[model samples]
Target: MDAEQQYHTVLAIAGFDGSGGAGIPADIKTISALGCYATSVLTALPVQNTLGVQALHAIPPEVVVKQLDALLTDIPPQAIKMGMVHTKAIVSALTKRLEAHTKVSLVLDPVMVSSSGHQLMEKSAIQAMITKLFPLTHILTPNLDEASLLAKMPIKTIDDMLQAGQKIKDLGCQSVLLKGGHLKGNTLTTIYFASDGQQHTYSFPKIETPNAHGTGCTLSSAIAAYLARGENELSAITKAQHYVYQALLQGKDVAIGKGKGPLNHFFDPEKTIKRKAESGKQGN
Candidate 1:
């Protein structure tokens, strides 16, 4: 096969959201919409919808490892996006499997809670994630609430976000994208702190809408998609944010459920992107 015929591949490791508004489903939509082939490994099963999470069933560590092994061996991804790792065992399993894939760009959305206020991660797993997965992460995308929890500090303002981002970055990730969607005001600011001591702040008008389900998953997956297409970290994040913003704007008026609705992932979908496959590799 011609190298140019190969599609850029992105793998999403996340929980299963039956509602299709979040988790692996949202990741797939976001990745595919951004013109990348999407692969996934389920980490947990959360029984919930746009309303809230009711119950959860985490995948066993061994099974999760087997899934990772199968995908990593057969369909090696150029980039990876991880969400909803609910247990310390799963975190450890992921770290062990991913340690060798240092070349792959990894976007970790430290999903700790749902939009409806349900805890998605086990408290004990926080430390494990910081110690094990953070180092392997190319970019850690955490919202205000999750950042506060990880940094063990309050983040009510941009200054607080900057301080918390530094604290999280010190935990060993290559970079941190601190999302400030929860901050009060008409303008939303997200800060990106790079490993080289560079910081970029992105501010945009807040779109007032209740249909924001799966936003974090979408943004992180979009970032992974852009990275798979060979974009630099800053470029990837900038494009991903634009994608999410447009999705939210396009889907704002549309209603899906009684509770919060989801973004229009297919608002302006792009065809699958093709790239030259690296020699000896399936996709890149």
Candidate 2:
């Protein structure tokens, strides 16, 4: 193997959704579509579909740690994306392993609830995630509901989103991306707040569609892929937002399930990116 030629790899630690609409499946699709090699560690197995999650079976904390150890030791990822940690034990396990690799950018999608209003995380895990995982996260991507839970307030407008984003950022993450898709309006606005006193606002017309399942997973994975390819946080997030927007627009009418369908993750896939292993830089 030539050190000069390597794949830009991203690791996704998340739950397994057999529906292929969310969780590990969505992460793999999104990362691969964005031109990165995706590796995953299944944290939980959720009996779910486009409709909603029925039940969840969590992987043991020790098993999860072993998986992390195997991957982090050999195919070390350039970036990591985490979603749907269901328990405090899993959070503690992940935190212990992640402490050694602080250099790797981590994009965390705090998935607390499913699109169909099913709780995906335990209430106790919320506090653990905030105390243990937030400081290690490079960027925290939380939708309106999750943000409301984290900030302990409702987000009904862009102003509320800004306030909520700031509040979440104060909890220790380097930055927060508060998604406003749930707000009642024709337009959706997402705000990004950084600890450095920088903020970015992204607003676009909402594409009315039921095929929006796994959007949060896709968006966060895309951000990790971009980061693996060496983009800055803001650039990676901006590109990822555009990718999700296009995916939603393209898959608006395509139906895959009885309930909400999934976005076409491979609508326009890119070739796997190559980079130099020794230099830790992207290569054409």
Candidate 3:
């Protein structure tokens, strides 16, 4: 193997969305876009589109376990990302597999609900996730909707975002990035709270568009890919946000479906490569 080859990897444990807007395919695209090798273990199959999810079928836990076992037996990932685990069985299976391989960072995208008023995760699965998976997560990224659900309060203001960030951090997550895209504002304020007793608030002028369906999946997966490439936690989160912001900005006018569409995760790969080189130079 060439020692200089940048082959960082992120393994995504997520569902399959045929629409390509979110889930396993989105994870693959985001990780690959950020210069990381993408791998996956599908947890569910959701019949979804830009409009809404029509149906969902969770994959059997044993099959999910077998896939993880096979993957972990061969190669290891630098980071692992969790998305759309809709069952307690899946929660338990993933937790067991992840606990066995403890070296990688885990980015948990708590996808309990969708933008279309669909309950993606079962109520029974919530406890399993909190008890088993939350402790394993290195970074938890939840949108304003999901954060409100986890924090057990309505999150509508910037102060609400900060309070919710603290509440989520107490739930065994080492760090939390409370996403503010769902909030009402011209500028989105992403709140990043770490275990280091410091907070980082990043603001981006909101892009007005309906083509932001898979932003959560893209953001978390991008962060995982950046972390896999040896970026610090906070830096990875910030860079991933920038990448997604750009992707959404460029994808706003794209008409992929009749409703809210996805981000252009592969919008500018050449530019990303150039930026990576520039950052590498700066680091040296």
Candidate 4:
């Protein structure tokens, strides 16, 4: 490989799922699939699968800080995605490290609950996330359930989603994307609220399938990858959501586990790479 030939890079700081359904593995897969190189820092080691998370063990704050420090000093990332921050200590470390390097676009996917109804984060961590983590985030991606929790209300309708977006934004993030997958409807809508008072709505046909695990993780990582590839924020998000929609459509009914399985992150990444390469050539 030529030393001058460089690809976009996204640094994912998330938990590790032993089953490879979500967390760091899923983030890596999503980033790579979106035509970017992926690097990672582990926040926790969770024994999890499609069925659900079994256990969680968070990495120490000091270790997490060290990893960020080394990465920032060396090959710094253009975009960063964070998932499954299980402790307040880890949240603090993330905030501090990000404060030092404010150029990288940061996506925070608040992974608060498990698929099986287990709490994935502590109450203290929730407070810390809002206080310490939110202000540093470029985008706060939250699914319906998470939006409901953070917004302190039920999100059963589009109006509720709008309300929730405002509430989440009040937490101090630069923007909020409230995913409407959990709403009871044939159409899935994702609402975006930017700090500039601009709001955008994206709608796609809902894919009814059991193989939808890690959708949040995949979506956030994809957005980061797109951003790293030099796309505008809204364009990056729109492209990423379309990628997830396509991945879900391709992987529907594909059974890899007993319960809700993971998305086919390996569906097709080459097309993305080729398209990007052609676009670059045209630019020159």
Candidate 5:
């Protein structure tokens, strides 16, 4: 096949955030920045801003299924990033689609709550999500709150994190990128566990910033984008984490809205080359 014909595509199954802080916008930004084409499916329409979510409207399961099927028929994605699925019906539809399209790699961002402390998914949808989609996931990215919810226990200490990692793996995901943002300390740690039973941890010096939003969405989408580009799961996760951290560190000084603003998704030079070329051509 020609090189252009072999272009990698990433599908993002997530909600719509008009503010671009989280959901499909963040997923598309992260994937595009990481050198992949992004396709999106909106699961929820939320009234939100940088401060928080005000209300949400879940898209019907039939509509969700139709959109997914249309994408599968026309543009087959190499990897999928799932975020903010608001209902069990949506989860059921997605699982059915995944069953039909089992070849695609999946990166799951279990987005239960927004960074500004807004609940995205319903309490009832949790178990359905765990049973239906967790096993199909190639990598599950969850913050401390999400991890604790999924683990059904408090994840406060290092030992608790490890135990939760193990338990999460046993729940059927191929790997877990357990985020530690909610843990208190001078440093932040994220744990990665592969299906092969190997565990690795990445830690970063905590930067004092309240403007970090969509970090989880960005990380998971970056991982999916890299995986679509043929990187292994562990390699993809490491690079994605570094990408997100740097994006956060760079955007720490900039201001966007009243609440938590977005990270600098364009922090990588190599990743921005294609975009710059396109813009330069457009300017001509």
Candidate 6:
């Protein structure tokens, strides 16, 4: 593709989910759905299935740093999305790289907990994320469970989500997308906490499915991809949610694994690629 039409690439620094539901695979799918390329740097390897994560082994901190440096040295992405950092060492390694390279857009998905009742990051790692990475993030996307963990308080209601959103903003992020998925209800709400002190609430009718494994990863990556393609932050998030909703709707029936299956990231009802290629060949 020509430079004008070349796909923008997003660097995803996260873990590997063998389940393909979350982590690096989900990030790649989300980026592709938005018509962007994705480059990955895996920090951990998780033995997971549709049911849940079975085991995890974190990559060495120095190895993770080496991956980041290799990518940055050759070709820096238009955006960066962070997922699972299993230790304070990994967090520090990431922070050092970020400090060295100050000219990148970063979307931090503070994944402290897993869907199957497991803590992914140690207390020191969580603290390092708050101290080192939060300030540099263009946007931070954390679910209610994550928000509560960070806030050191329970988030049981919409009011709590609102409060947590502001508190997250106080942690130095330019904006926060507080997802309200863990709260019990038929409706799901997400709040956007802007650095300008403006807050906006987005609500969607919750789809009842046990297979919603990679929603957070997908959402954050989608936001990053859109931003890389020149969309404003708010606009990027809004569009990303729309894309996610459609993917969920498409994957509701297709079961790939025994546990919670992933949403179909590529659900192009129209064959846009084929049509574009034909048009290009015909000099249209």
- How many clashes does each candidate structure show, in the order listed? 0, 0, 0, 0, 0, 3
Per-model lDDT: 0.93, 0.92, 0.87, 0.86, 0.85, 0.84
Q: Candidate 5 lDDT, tens digit per residue, 1-284? A: 22223456899999988888778999888888887888988888989989888888879999999999888877778899999887888898899889877778899998888766778888878888999998798899988899988888999988899999888888988889899988889989999988898999889999788768888888889999888887988899988888998999998998898988888887763542222222222211
- State the RMSD for candidate 2: 2.2
Deviation in Å, model 6, residue 162 alpha carbon: 0.8
Instruction: Give lDDT tens digits, candidate 1, residues 1-284.
Output: 67555788999999998888899999999999999999999999999888888999979999999999898888889899999898999999899889999999999999999888888898889999999999999899999999999999999999999999999999999999999999999998999999799999999999988899999999999999999999999999999999999999999999888888889999999999877666787533
Which has the greatest lDDT?
A: 1
Candidate 6 Cα deviation (angstroms), residue 283: 28
lDDT of 5 at 120: 83
Candidate 2 off by > 4 Å: 1-3, 279-284
Q: Give the runs in model 3 whose Cα sits over 4 Å from its true position.
A: 1-6, 270-284
What TM-score would every model get versus the actual structure?
Answer: 0.97, 0.97, 0.93, 0.93, 0.92, 0.92
Residue 199 in model 2: lDDT = 95
**Predicted candidate 6 versus true structure: per-residue lDDT over 1-284, tens digit per residue:** 33224447789999998878899999988887777778899999988888787888979999999999888876567789999987999998889889866567799999987888777889999888999898889899999888988888899999999887888889888899999987898988999987777888889998876668899999999899888777888898898888888888888888788878898888863222211222233221
The CA lDDT at 120 in model 4 is 87
| Predicted candidate 3, C-alpha RMSD | 4.7
Task: Give the candidates in order of TM-score, highest first.
Answer: 1, 2, 4, 3, 5, 6
Clashing pairs in 3: none
Cα lDDT tens digits, model 3, 121-216, are 988899889889999989999998888888999998999898989998998989999899888879989989987969999999999989998899
Where model 5 places Cα greater than 4 Å from the true spot, the runs are: 1-4, 269-284
Flag regions of model 1 displaced more than 4 Å: 1-4, 282-284
Q: Could you say which candidate leads in TM-score?
A: 1
Per-residue lDDT of model 4, residues 182-267, tens digit only: 88879999999976989999999898899988899999999999998889889989999999999999999798878888898988
Instruction: Give candidate 3's whole-model lDDT.
Output: 0.87
lDDT of 6 at 223: 93
Clashes of 6: 3
